[model samples]
Target: MAYELYYWDGIQGRGEFVRLALEEAGAEYIDITRESGRGRGTGAMLAIMQSDGEALPPFAPPFLKDGDLIISHVANILLYLGPKLGLVPDDEALRYVVNGLQLTITDFVAEVHDTHHPIATSLYYEDQKEEAKARSAAFIKERIPKFLGYFEKVLNQNPEGSDYIVGNALTYVDLSLFQIVEGLVYAFPKAMSNYRGSYPLLAALRDRVERRPNITHYLRSDRRLAFNTEGIFRHYPELDIGVS
Candidate 1:
């Protein structure tokens, strides 16, 4: 049976990471909101969020329905899909290593989200622009380097080689890294460009992930949503420079 992916229909947001992996692996799945002609728009997401069933629901978008299992949380979802999709090795040791890397990625993602809404998610960026500026500064000056450095360390320590994050083959960790790099570049072009050269392995991995046939096709197709302020990683000029 095909998997049922439940996510806000609009803006790639967190869902894009899952989408990229599924597409890359050529996994069969149905995008629920999209099929109802209610996906791919912000309205669809608003409806999902406002629904009373959300609390008991998966807790967030990017959840997947596989047979009787309903899974949420990006990292947890990947942990479940990685094995079934053959994106990870069969070895228990290697799988745990990849899961550890994934949890680190989750930390990085949360920090990224906080850059724009350091004060509170309930407040709008315009209302907390000043705080966001301060947060963004810390993120670019300290957090980005630290997280990137950790990933670089992982790559360097991967005795298997810097070609992939786990063993000698492609894994969900690699895909998550690609998403991180892409999101960072999109949300902070100047900062990302300035520091990108320092991490050659990560840059190469991003390039390889993009070149994969499935990813290339999805990106070129209209299915991919362009990044904008509506998503978690919004690019505000003032926030980018620690002003306003």
Candidate 2:
């Protein structure tokens, strides 16, 4: 059976990370909300969430439905799918290490989301513009360097090589890091202009992931959603601070 991925329509959001893995692995999956049918579309996804009969209800979109199992959260979904998709190594110890890296990436993603919605997700960007600017300035100055630098260090210290984040092989974590780089560039082009120089190893890894045959095709195809202001990584002119 095809894996069912449930995420909001029109934005890449958190779902893109899973989508990238499925795409790269050539795995069969249905993007539920993006399609329309009797048991498809955003309504179907919401119905599952709203259903009282559901024993394992997901708190939000971007959950994965594989057979009778429902996996929620990007890290959790990726962890479950990694071995099956051949995106994660078989070494028991290494799997935990990869899961940790993914959880860290999840932390970084939450921080990225907070940059534009510092005050509240309920408030509009215009309402929180000033706060967002302050938050983004701090993020660009410290958090970006802190997070990206750590990943760079990971790549630098990798026992296998710097080509991939965790092991010598490409994992879901690499796919996710690619999305982070892409989203950051889209949401803060000016701020990330120096990313290549500052995070050279990460930059190289991003480039390598981009050049993969499946990834290259997926990126060019319509399945990959573009980063927009409506999504997690919103670009406000005032929120982007240039490198000092």
Predicted candidate 1 versus true structure: per-residue lDDT over 1-244, tens digit per residue: 9887777666778887788779888999887777656353444544554678655565568777788677888888988888888899889888988888889988888899999888889998788888888889989989988999888878888889998977888999898899888888889887887555689988888888889888899889887888888787788877675212
Q: Residue 57 in candidate 1 has what lDDT?
A: 60
- Candidate RMSDs in Å, in order, are 3.3, 0.7
Best by TM-score: 2
Candidate 1, run of 10 with poorest lDDT: 38-47
What are the lDDT figures for the candidates, one per model? Answer: 0.81, 0.93
Taking the candidates one at a time, how many backbone clashes does each contain? 1, 0
List runs of model 1 lying over 4 Å from the truth. 37-56, 242-244
